[model samples]
Target chain A: MQMLRKLSAGLLLLAVASFASTPAAEAAGQTLEIVKKRGHLKCGVSQGLPGFSTPDNRGNWTGIDVDFCKAVAAAIFNDADKVKFTPLSAKERFTAIQSGEVDIIARNTTWSMHRDTALGVDFPVVNYYDGQGFMVRADLGVRSARDLDGATLCTNQGTTTELNAADYFRSNGMQYEIVAFEKADESVAAYNSGRCDAYTTDHSALYAQKLKLSDPKAHIVLPEVISKEPLGPLVRQGDAAWNDLVRWTHYATVAAEEFGVTSKNISEMKSSSNPSIRRLMGQDGSFGDNLGLSKQWAVHIIRAVGNYGEIFERNVGVKTPLGIKRGVNALWTKGGLQYAPPIR
Target chain B: MQVLVLAAVLGAMAWLVGNVQSNLERQNINSGFGFLSERAGFGINQTLIAYTEDDSFGRVLAVGLLNTLLVSALGIFFATLLGFSLGVARLSRNWLISKIAMVYIEIFRNVPLLLQIMFWYFGVLRNLPSPRQAVSIGDAIFMSNRGFVVLWLEASAGAFWYGLAALGLVIGGIWLRRRAANAQITTGQATRVWRPLLGLAVALFGGAALMAGVPFALDVPHLKGFNFRGGLTVIPEFVALLLALSLYTAAFIAEIVRAGINSVSKGQREASAALGLPESVALRLVVIPQALRVIIPPLTSQYLNLTKNSSLAVAIAYPDIVSVLAGTTLSQVGQALEIIFITMMIYLSLSLLTSWAMNRYNQRMAFVGNNT
Candidate 1:
């Protein structure tokens, strides 16, 4: 009994000591220093959401989100492969970042006011302009969202998509049932097996997942975009420098596309007469230095992952299996939402 | 010294909580239960109570808890019944029956419970035909990918009074059984209690039910446009989870039962047989009571395991407490600290209550004095 009492006392002291040491640990901007010290960026992505971040049989990560992570690595180390991917579920993604398990979360998470203010995470830029939409069988004769009365919809649980779906049906006075699954694949499988009349998620994900159905030609995606979903890369709060670096890594891709700079012609564009392109390519000014990166960081990003347009078209655009049209995702000059601040 | 140790532990706990609070403040993560009263704004497919998208998070949590308990209770009931049968079958003299029971226990216990649940859900239940091609039973029950629809009784207004009459009959039957047992013990006269008690109960409940124009009516399922129109529709999630949980837990329970029966000595059974008691009566009156002494303790653990393992309902999206409340609600509210702590406390209390009740039964069955 005496030994047991002493053991418990020792445990109590250890607990208190551990608690006393945490405040000093979280101070002094730890994320960037740790990343540089480790020499690799731990980027969190989706478990297997096609066109976002799915791995091939060779264990190589692909898709647009994977490209964004590689671009960040290139800007920091001039080597896109100096990054490791951590596949996470939507329920576990925020906690993963908050706990410092991953440096940045590039998962296709929607930016919302509640998440920004309360979840202790900050979204620096929207990488994908997405919105909630529904996909149903063509034979259902459901032409629009209003035609989905008395329909059973399958979706991934613990997401903004579930709430938006419920609110839409409730406000429209339509009776519907939602069969939510823990993972995106489970929801897709259920939808494919005819357990639900429609499958609802982000418009881009619906397009990507529809290609996996046994009879892909039988389903048609509805045209209505129910909720604004500005998907972006997120980082833990209070790391200003790291957040800025990740933010600019994405913007550099968008800005590259706007300047009509292809990855093949990036080296040749260095001699361009356009002053903005010269400054963006780091031939003039301290644009990269201001963000605590090398002068040619944008050049490294472009060479590593190409521009935003290239990444999208190769992974999910008209020629890919997903074949998603760039509607609102087009450049701002072309009447869309992909805008980047001037490099100057 | 013990008091000092407890005080040190308490001090550590308080300091840790203070550390978390400061960290949360710095990170700007909200730390309160005020989100409980906010609108849930999400739909649940299956709910025991009245719920809508506009319901509060508190109501959603309550609904999730009810669903968790409902599945766990059903799993425990069916697993125990199947386990006791398999346990006896394993000990049967017939070699084929014993081998069949052994094979069942081996197959279920070797595989992980989560895999079993997913196999039943995705591989088996999800492959069923859609509602358009639903398989029906006697034109009253239907099975499809949507759900299993069964004909059920819809009670009328007079059913309430009829239920009261049935309760009274049950109480009278219990009294008659005690009187008959006492009469047989003291006077050596076997009273026909079952016939009289059953007759009285039937007359009371059945007569009142008939006079009230049959207080219950059958609600049959019919084919609708895309699904069944009426009756109680059991969701595929519940069926798959329940089937997996009961089968997996019953395997462990069968082993426990076998060990319990073996713990009872052969001499006790032989003695009962020498006393001219029939084989069935001797096994029930002598062997079972002794076997129960060993069974009740471990049996409590299996029950608790079933309850906690029900948390795996999330994998198949059964909307249990962990899936709906701690999972979806926690992500929506971003109050993981409070939500996880509350879920842990709820499960702890449930296990404690179950063990407490089982311990009482164990004490009743314990030997009166130290004889061995």
Candidate 2:
């Protein structure tokens, strides 16, 4: 009996070793397939950026970036709620996506050339157009960013804002000290507590974080927008189908809005005669097929999160506490920069 | 059978690495050290060496290394001083001093180091009055939310000669100490070395200052338009990091120190007392040397802990190595594997070097054969 048990234990060890030696190449090109097999989409998001991705007391995530991931889930599973959110920090977001800890990263990550070519990830579309800006206390007599000479600024570490703030200050011949914190709220707390003369970030985030101050009305964002920050959702490289699916999910929402298709009226508007709307709604084309998604992908997405305008208005529009206007994020028809190509 | 098992483990590891390498190549993420030379476009808040946004990543890494070393060395020095005092105080006969030291160790060591860091940074330092309302320390130091600004001495060309004079005085002090010890050993008479040492310091430094025309001029920080204009500035983040690291590490070191001192047998002290040596001399000569043997190995570990814990400076944005280089550079270059590997290796080597030095010291303190 002892001999038999030893032989069985040796066989079990050999089996475990064989399983461990399986190569990673087989897992490289099938993010979509794996996510499908896993029965849900794993979405990477910020830990808590108020208007972008914040969790409620009930632990339900609600934000524009959260809406984007929900839309992607609806496109895949026809159930917007069939997605889990992994709250990642600025330092861990890219690695989370790279390691396949999450299938897609819908964090408000800026689309930069260096990240695109270097990080082995592809940013599908620019969901929000933002620029770096500064906010100072009204009592500081600092009217513009140029008046920010010798200012100590507080910002989150491991972000583009740090480099942008450095560049803007150096070029403008201002000597500034930046006190960076690991989390966004920590930096804001430092700024709110008077540890710094000013706080800087993407202009939209500045507005979102300003509301968190003790006296929100006491700080004014500076006028100068330093760098172009085109924030978007991204996926790992080497998966073209997965990349295309994410890209088209963003485009579908924009196209639905341009065609005057709201989630409330999407079912009723299905009978409309505009062929562009028809193709976008997946009414009469192989568009979703080409992207390897079901034909009703656009309908599911629009139904889940409404059009792009709806998501923006609900989370961060002028009516909301964030009060961010869709200046450059509006549709091209409305003289904004958001323009998507025809589905056909 | 053992060799076969080891071979199997190594073979499995090799296969896994080969698989990962192939996957990384397929995914087009470049893996190498060549990218270390690329321009690091980020700026660090505190730099010991000259660094700009235009400097290469390698230089930034160098700056980070210097910062890490500065904080660690400073932390080790301060922690040791503070720990030794607390340890001695813990054994004090006075009820108040001993209890106070006990309370201090319990409070600092029991609470998380990270929380203490945040409390010092966000709760204490950040809430200080603004720069314009900075609190003054006499006329040489200023404290505010902006930073700790102190009057710095600007040495002119003649200051180099003064530095030489100071060096000579230090050498003279050491020589006088050795001579006094030799005299006591030979003549069985204790010589008072303090007077000569103090006189030599005062005369040498005073003469150097007069000859060099009072070379150092104090540059006090003055209020500028929005902030302080020009003294040596210690940013609040750095202050908080230093304060938190030293205090927290000191608590652990105190416990180690108390244990070490307690490890010296009571018989030794009693024997020294019987030999008619003073209590102070018994502690300084007989007790401490023996206690240090027990103290140093664990004390070395504490020093290493403080160095490693310095990485938490990232939480408060002090721009230590883990913060500036590993955090920012890894994100920018997209060389997570390479950057993380290199960072781990750097820390590994740092700990190894520290252990090696401490071990050498330990060996020196160790009792020789038949000495015990």
Q: List the residue pairs that clash in candidate 1.
A: none
> What's candidate 1's DockQ score?
0.64
Model 1 segments more than 4 A misplaced: A1-12, A19-24, B206-212, B368-372
lDDT of 1 by residue, A1-344 (tens): 89987987897788678765654365346777777789999999998988999999999999999999999999988999999999988888888887677889999999999999998889989999999999999997788988888788999987999899999998899888888888899899989988898999999999889988999999999999999999999998888888899888988999999999879999999999999899889999998988778899999999999999999998889999998888889999999999999888
Task: Report how far off residue A262 is in candidate 2 (Å).
Answer: 0.4
Clashing pairs for predicted structure model 2, backbone only: none
Which runs in model 2 stand beyond 4 Å of their true positions? A1-27, B1-18, B194-212, B368-372
Q: Candidate 1 lDDT, tens digit per residue, B1-372?
A: 878777888887888888888888788788888988999999998899999988999999899999999999999999999999999889999999999999999999999999999999888988888887888888777889887989989999989878888888889988998999999999999888888987887788877867686888889887654467668889999999999999999998999999988888888888888999998898788887888988989999999999999999998888999999888998898888899998999899989999999999899988732214
Which one is best on lDDT? 1
Q: Candidate 2, residues B188-273: lDDT per residue as tens digits?
A: 99999899989998888888878887787878789986789878989888889899999999999999889988988888899899
Q: What is the C-alpha DockQ of each candidate?
A: 0.64, 0.52
Q: Looking at candidate 1, what is the lDDT of residue A187?
A: 90
What is candidate 1's CAPRI-style docking category based on DockQ? medium
- Best candidate, DockQ-wise? 1
In angstroms, the error of model 1 at B162 is 2.3
